[model samples]
Target: MVKYGAFVLFYLSIVWIVSSCSSSTVEPDAARLGYTYFPLEEKSFAIYEVEETIYSLTSTPVTRNYQIKEVIAEQFRDLSNEEAFKVMRYSRQNTTADWELDSVWVAKRTANRAIRTENNRSFVKLIFPVEESQKWNGNVLNELGADEYEFSQVAKPFTIANQPYTSTATVMQVNDSSACNMKRVYEVYAQDIGLIYKEKILVDYRQTNNICEGLGDIQAGVQLYQKLLNYGKE
Candidate 1:
């Protein structure tokens, strides 16, 4: 009887351990996947103000300010019979200037992923079941090298231009810590608004040591910033 009781106690302990481990891995809610942040709805359009700075080794650095309008111009089925969107990009120097056709891109959303094809290159922008701190390869669909993408600030509040967003998700794409070269890229998407802000910086230190002394001096690189100025349907 003593040995049987001991065996039963060990069995119950093992069962408890297994149950604890299973419960710890909480299954993310499907409704909270953050797919609304991508907003593939037809007639969606977003305007963004762009500021770009270019650095050159032998020439003086230059900066340009402009605005871009991205509109969902068309929707069609891709080769795989998946729904795809054609995004038409238009650019203007200022509010009073005419919009010039800039570029064309494509985007699609699957049951498991949100993908955008820019310049004939496909990128897995977001994965379903958007759990905080979840990591995935942003370049999974493209030929580019593997890029680790992590989600943070999930469903967090963010404000821009005195406007408030209830929930936003930030994708941290690239953040290099090397001193000789620096590359930081990230994008912020607002729920029901698509992409709201972006920043990309890749610069090389100009000092004799070829290492970063500060952000002010750069040998050759580019810095780009895009912030949503307006958004609406159609």
Candidate 2:
């Protein structure tokens, strides 16, 4: 009876260990899979912005021959709140640069809010983190008087860099110029497979004239499917 009891105890111990390992080994939630944050000193930043006006001169007839939607895609890397503020301040200051001036100079000041995964190689959430572009363009900057008004818009969701992300944005203001509020959400494990899995956008205005309309989320799920096939193969 003593030997039998000891054997049973050992069997139970083995089962317990296996159960513990299995539970521990299970993948974490998509939100936690590779969440990454940065301390003040560690955060770094890079800037990229696009303007539609430049394409106005394009012989390709931007709205017809080329994909004009991609132009609004702006990206920023890890940056401190202070750094991001400066970037925005400068962006507002150099609206001409962001619109028609050389991209090289304005690109240097590109900064926006973003959340990256722990690996740094992937992004979990990358958003502009601005409440309203109009407030900045109007009251703060005083670039325009009472005669000017503004609004913004947003996109739905999408993926990038082999991960899934959701984009939410909409028209923020419609003052001297038309603008939109945009954001991107990313996670290590997302439902779709694509570089640009999904997108949601709202363009309040195109330039100085017409309101932005008929703009849809550019789907790239198919391309991501193909890329995944070649991923890590080489």
Candidate 3:
């Protein structure tokens, strides 16, 4: 459970050469750019409530909820000698519990893109101009298979946790639904607040006679959801 849980929780980023291919693009306003959604300034931190659910074929499903804090600790040169930020993560059972150091990840935002390195996989999280219907390669830097990411709902106002965000965008990464299996992954970022929400769902249903008998019953899979609770810069 620990291995799969930790592996699924991390995020990924990419190479800078990927070209932007817009499909009926809706131009973003000049004031709300893509990089603002994921500010990488040192000492910036955000807290989130992470809920994870695991499903099994032989037993009932199990779920766990906890809180995590991610802080941009320091700036350093990555292997490629590019300027990057070191993000330290802490975990706790709840808000009242003390945070314990959990893991470390790297992130960098260039003039036109934002990149995150988690679990040794780098993926492009966002691209510049914040245009709706714009697509870019998410796995260009790593050996992982090609994955396309698109931006939608750009510079749109949203309300969460009783707080109103002036501008936000959605990164639609993957959406695959089948009779026996379903998988989806996406992340939302609010302008000036970084990642506001994320959800990843993967499920496998038991099939009989090569057909799904229990369409809604899970055989084995995982579901993870994260929502921002607070954010600040120190």
Candidate 4:
């Protein structure tokens, strides 16, 4: 009777352990959480103000500013057989001018990632569970030859164009090479609001083979940035 009781007790302990392990392994819904950072619902839209600057050794620096509006127009199946939202983008030289259709972009969200395609190049912009210091190749499938991007900030507060965001994520990409010069791009996103800010800068330097012998090397650079101004929902 004593041996039988001991065996029964061991069997009960094994069942308890298995049950606990199974419960612990269960994960929350990744798709639901990922969509909060990159919403792709039809008729959702955002507007931004863009600033561009160009620096060259041959002439003075040039600066231009504009505004862009992005709206989710429809849905379609992407090449990967996934449902993607088609976004229509419009731009204007200023707020006073009328918006002109600029381009169409595609965005899709999966259980683990959020992707956006522009100009025929697809990019993985966000990862699930939104953690800081998480790194992935934003241009992995695009063949853009860019470096791995990093989530430098998560759930941080940021403001753009006088509008404040309580929680935001910042993804940073820095690519420095002798052949292609140095470039850095920053993309900031707010929960349920999509991208709020974007900045890109590229710098290249080389010796000038001109008649001016004392001019030495020439430095040329370009910077482009966008800030969120307003948004609307359907």
Candidate 5:
């Protein structure tokens, strides 16, 4: 989890650059904007909870319920999957929760080229995991947690935790019906702590990205989930 702090640092630095430019007369170079994280090409490990029901404290109650999951991983910057998984397993083994491994995933790269309105070109790279079904031609629909999904072509503005951002040209590279795309929004959240750039899949829809992979033969899904939670933290 400490490693995630570095990812936070990178995001904070980006925000600083933006703020510094906004305050000064100097025009920022939009072309120079980009992001990269540790475990650069290795793999990512974390923990996740597949919720069974919707719990509400208010009288109105929630009309819908979805699985709740936790992903703790090294925040993107300069890190490795080994570092993330080691820490994650240690944490879980020491924690009080009776959590067990849910799934394990291998990292896959998905790079996208975006042309800004100002004619600035930037490339965004996302490293996620591809589940067994997505990679192999095995079970179709008969499985419980596997489903195909599609994403919107239009871009949308959203906030992470609370920070605000403008995410243009939305894309869905993964297809998992269990994942939610509407309630959760992918964005770049600029907080006092740092910048958190990730995809917040809706709680109802646990969709996966084509950029991700579930290659390794391990069942420690919780560890991988936690790794993702800490994706931007370290």
Candidate 6:
């Protein structure tokens, strides 16, 4: 009877160990929890309407409207020995025009942060378990100037192109640096999707004091923006 009891206890111990191991192996649902705002999966794609405005101190502002289609083409390893996805961007003059390949970028996500490379410059795009008011030096690893990046809002409701997102975050450039030349960028991301909107503005105040007189104090600059129109994921 003693030996039988000991065997029963041993079997129960094995079962408990297995149960614990299985539970530990389960992965956390970052998407469902709204922890990861940018989901970078292959074949995932988004379409946006792009507008670029150039303001000149001596002349009138010029605005150009276009369409952009961004897609995750494939996966590859970046120079840092980290896994990354290749993103392709196609642009056209309008919705009725044909798209032309514009540029290619790379994006990588780790446990703590998301990194993206564009125009030969790499920067941290997002931080995991996103929290509002979180600040970081986005250009720290890039050896660029101390450009501050901040999460202005987290898990907020946002709407674009008639599509509403329950969980959205806005990341903004908050540093005042001469290197920026009064340039600023803002990016918005939606849960389970990727970038929903982006805006870049450059203000050149040295051109003329009366520049942009009706608009603001700036002399000359450019404003580039993109808004998500649709998205699909495989």
Off by over 4 Å in 5: 1-99, 110-156, 160-169, 172-234
Task: Put down candidate 5 lDDT per residue, 176-222, tens digits, no spaces.
Answer: 43222223333232212112343433333222463323333211121
Q: Once superposed on the true structure, which residue ranges of model 3 sit more than 4 Å away at CA?
A: 1-32, 213-215
Model 5: number of backbone collisions: 61
The estimated TM-scores of all candidates read: 0.84, 0.24, 0.82, 0.77, 0.26, 0.81
lDDT by residue for model 2 (110-228), tens: 23323222222222132233232332322222233532222133234433455434532332222122232222311121222112222222222232334333223221111111111
Best candidate, TM-score-wise?
1
The superposed Cα distance between candidate 2 and the true structure at residue 96, in angstroms, equals 42
Off by over 4 Å in 2: 1-8, 11-27, 30-54, 58-234
Off by over 4 Å in 6: 1-26, 32-35, 175-184, 205-214
111: Cα error in model 6, Å: 0.6
Q: Each candidate's root-mean-square deviation in Å?
A: 11.2, 14.8, 16.7, 8.0, 18.4, 4.3
TM-score of 2: 0.24
* lDDT against the true structure, each candidate: 0.88, 0.28, 0.85, 0.82, 0.30, 0.82
Off by over 4 Å in 4: 1-32, 175-182, 205-218
Q: Model 1, 58: alpha-carbon shift in Å?
A: 1.3
- Please tell me which model should have the higher TM-score, number 4 or number 6: 6
Candidate 5 lDDT score relative to the true structure: 0.30
Candidate 2: how large is its RMSD?
14.8
**Angstrom error at residue 225, model 5:** 14
TM-score order of candidates, best first?
1, 3, 6, 4, 5, 2
lDDT of 6 by residue, 1-234 (tens): 999999999999999999998887686668644446878889989999989988886788889999999899889887778889998989999878998999998888887888888867889888776888888888976878987889977889998777788889999975343532576788999888879999898776553443333335555788898999989975
Q: Please provide, for model 1 over 154-192, each residue's C-alpha lDDT reduced to its tens digit, 9 standing for 90 to 100.
A: 999988888888888999999994767789999998888
Worst 10 residues of 3 by lDDT: 11-20
Query: Mind giving the per-residue lDDT tens digits that candidate 4 earns over 104-136?
Result: 988898878888889888999987867889889
